[model samples]
Target: MEIETTGIPGCYVLQARLLRDRRGSFIKTFHTPRFEELGLRTDWREEYFSASAKGVVRGMHFQLPPVDHAKMVFCLTGEVLDVVVDLRRGSPAFGTALGFTLSAENGRGLYLPTGCAHGFVSKAEDSGMYYKVTSVHAPEQDAGIAWDSIAFDWPVSDPELSDRDRRHPRFADFETPFVFDAAKAAQ
Candidate 1:
């Protein structure tokens, strides 16, 4: 895997090595050593995926600290404009965002350290997004900032959002508790 910085201090955009043949292709999605060498959190406890139709918007979500997580996500099928907002209280990139296009064709992915909110918009029908997270899911700990409040430029105006997601507080109204500790997050 090759790593690229996401401008946000600890966030990385990973490009998986794809091997192609006459019949098909194969790619190594994860390798413990490489992630360790890069100082990313590797203690993943759960994995999940979300499938959305075109124009559907899925997130801007994160869990509260003590239950907060770092995530590595990639597009398993179709495509998405993956978006993340820095919410680390003392982060240099706080309140900012970055967007990357993840698709089955390019085999690209994203790694977000704890404190950023993550979400995506589907660019194709039946888009599937897969994730490997450092923390287990907790319903009570789940939270998000309003998707429409962030500065990132989403492609669609009429994004399909769930009522809960639609009701999330605006970015300006959020009071983040996550702190930006390089050493702590590297674990």
Candidate 2:
């Protein structure tokens, strides 16, 4: 697999090899040693998959500190416009938004560090998104910024959203608890 850094510190685009045969295709999204070599988190405590229809937007979410985690998200089927925003106050890229197109055909995954928020919009029908996170879901710690608060240009203006997502605080109103550690980020 090939790992490429993004504009946000500690975030990466992991390109895994895709092998195809006469009948089907195969992909290995994770390898302990490879992730170790790249200094990426391999201790995934929880995994989840979300299926969404085209034009569905699900995000701008993250957990608060104490349960904040590094997450790796990829498209298991179909495609999505994955988006991330840096929330660490001291980081140079704080409040910066970056978008990536993750798809089954592309064999790519987005790796986000602890101080980032993530969300994605389904670009194709019956899209499935897989996630491997360093920490388990913590309901009390669950948090998010309003999706529209950022400068990202989402594909749909009136995309569908859940009531919870609709209630998230706007970016400017959020008091972030995450702190950017330059030393840890360098690794």
Which structure among the candidates has the greatest lDDT? 2
lDDT of 1 by residue, 1-187 (tens): 9999877878989999988889877877799999989888779999998999999998899999789999999998999999999998778888898899999889999999989899999999989999999999999999999998999889999999999999999999999998888666543
Clashes (backbone N, CA, C under 3 Å), per candidate, total 0, 0
RMSD each, Å:
1.1, 1.1
TM-score, cand. 2? 0.98
Runs in model 2 with CA error above 4 Å?
none
Best by TM-score: 2
Candidate 1 differs from the real structure by a C-alpha RMSD in angstroms, to one decimal, of 1.1
The per-residue C-alpha lDDT of model 2 at residue 162 equals 95
What digit string (tens of lDDT, one per residue) describes model 2 on residues 84-180?
Answer: 9999999999999999999999999988999899999999998999999988899999999999999888888998999999999999999999889
- Write down the lDDT that model 2 would get: 0.92
For each candidate, give its TM-score against the true structure.
0.96, 0.98
